[model samples]
Target: MDTLALKILFMVGFIAAWAIRTPYQKRDKQTKRLAARLVLRERVLFVLIYVGMVILPLIYVFSPWLSPADYHSSLWAGYLGAIFFAISLWLLWRSHHDLGRNWSPTLEIREGHTFVSSGIYQKIRHPMYAAFWLWCVAQALLLPNWVAGLAGMISFGIMYVLRISNEEQMMLQHFGEEYKAYMQRTKRLIPYLF
Candidate 1:
């Protein structure tokens, strides 16, 4: 497939992902938070993620600025990317659905938050993160531009490395032994594997 077609395909998937998250994002705003840790460092990381996952990808799709970094990928790779993108969307939706009002954009424990160990969470402690990893994979395969394509992984990887320990610690503090046992049994992302 041509680059233009591939870009268009990516936009469709992106828009669908956005639509899936819209309701959940809005719902999260109304739910009262019991605690939150939106520190400056966390805010900066989020900004980086926004630039990488949203701004850079948009620039690559809509402008010629990233054309110089474009590379050819096999047709099969593009098809595989579409598949990965679809799976990411599914996992994203499922993660939000299973978490319900327990979900928050930042490190937060909502009022009445319960330890969720069902649905996708039954096997993976962070299915949402796994979905995002798949998203980055899809982005890399679909964009065909070195800087734009890899930006999501580079940015999110940094944030994941810096934030996951803190996130798990917060969970341990809140849920105590329950979360610790969950962690012992479940992988962070993959099912029975990491």
Candidate 2:
């Protein structure tokens, strides 16, 4: 497919993702937080993630500023990206649906947070992150721009690396042995293999 078509597809996926998260985000604001680690570093990383995943990609889609960094990808790759995008959307929905009120944008436990170990959470500790990895792969294939395409992975990778251990530690502190057993049974992002 042509680059314009690919960009349109990416936008559709992006909008769909936003649609999926909007209600959850709205609801999360009403949920009381029992614990939070929204430190300055975390806040900065979150902003970087937004810049990489949302701003840069949107700029690439809407303007020619990133065209100098554009690279041609195979048509098949774009098709593969569409598939990945679809799966990512499904996983995103499932993750949010399964977690429900337990979901939060930041590192915090809600007042009535429960240990979720069902559905997508059954095999992996973080289906949402897995969905994001797929989304990043999809973006790289769909955008065709070096900076915009790869930014999601780069920024999210940094955040994941810096935050995942702390996230798990928080879970450990909250759930204690239950989380440890869950950790023993499930991989962080992948199932069985990782």
Each model's lDDT comes to 0.92, 0.94
lDDT of 1 by residue, 82-153 (tens): 999999999999999999888888998898889999999999999999999999999999999999999999
**Model 1 residue 163 lDDT?**
90
In candidate 1, stretches whose alpha carbon ends up further than 4 angstroms from where it belongs are none
List candidate 2 stretches off by more than 4 Å. Answer: none
Q: Which candidate leads in TM-score?
A: 2
- lDDT over C-alpha atoms for residue 70 of model 2: 93
- Residue 167 of model 1 has an lDDT of 94
| lDDT tens per residue, model 2, 1-194 | 99999999999999999999999999999999888985788899999999999999999999999899998889998999999999999999999999999999889888989999999999999999999999999999999999999999999999989989899999999999999999999998988888
RMSD of each: 0.9, 0.8
Show the colliding residue pairs in model 1. Answer: none
Clashing pairs in 2: none
Model 1: lowest-lDDT 10 consecutive positions: 33-42
